[model samples]
Target: MAATEQEESLDDLPPSAKLVFKVLEYNGPLTQKGIAEETMLSARTVRYALERLEGISLVTEDVYFADARQNLYQLTEPAEEFTASDGEEATCAD
Candidate 1:
């Protein structure tokens, strides 16, 4: 299906949060710093996005195995699940 940005499952989230979700969706788990670098968002914004996603159980937060001070972020399910749950369209790659 040809999906538009508005058709994404993260419609209820801010664009930055959706972007963070997409980043994790495609790149697997990454540290907050990695996410900030990847999305070009500020650290604070990334934190907010993670908090939002976690609140809905759409994302998971874990301590980085290699780093004691940083946290890793990743999606809880496949891209399709996010869309399917919201009755929207999956907008990310496998």
Candidate 2:
């Protein structure tokens, strides 16, 4: 999709959700702990954002290879398309 269109799609997301998206984009797949650390969000906050993102079909989680206790998350195609937009540089809250 075009960048502008992508940005528009992201317009409904809350700031926390946007932050999770950016972290996933920059770091590739990440565990919950990694996301919390990278985004400087509390673990509970990250979980909440991930759940919200997943509800929108924007993010997905999978089992981590080395650690069964952890799940790695990454952006779905739609999310990548959204973040690629040019109207604004997406920012994640620290």
Candidate 3:
């Protein structure tokens, strides 16, 4: 989807999901447990937040090589997508 669409989708999500997204954006890929710890949210809440993010295609899940039993979550867009030629990062609401 377009960036505008993504922004709109993100706006529609609950605050918990938005927090989770921001945490991932700043911390890079992490396991569900890591997300919960970073956000200070419960595991169940983090799971729901991840679900919402995945539903919007904003997040992707992959096997965590270090632990096959767990999965790593990360933003779909690379860091470069949020960076301009001049090296400024895009705002979340932009």
The TM-score leader among the candidates is 3
lDDT of each: 0.84, 0.83, 0.92
What's the lDDT of the predicted structure labeled candidate 3? Answer: 0.92
Clashes of 1: 0
Which candidate's lDDT is highest? 3
Per-residue CA lDDT of candidate 1, range 27-66, in tens? 9999999999999999999999998788767898888989
Indicate whether candidate 2 or candidate 3 has the larger TM-score: 3
**lDDT for 50 (candidate 3):** 96
What is the TM-score of each predicted model, taking all chains together? Answer: 0.71, 0.71, 0.74
**Candidate 2 lDDT tens digits, 1-94:** 5664455445587898899998898889999999999999988999998987887678888999989999989988755445647777666556
Weakest ten-residue segment in model 3 by summed lDDT: 85-94
Worst 10 residues of 1 by lDDT: 1-10
Report the lDDT of model 3 for residue 92: 67
Candidate rank order under lDDT: 3, 1, 2
Candidate 3 residue-wise lDDT, 11-84, digit = tens: 89999999999999999999999999999999999999999899888999999999999999999976666777
- What candidate 2 gets wrong by more than 4 Å, as runs, is 1-9, 79-94
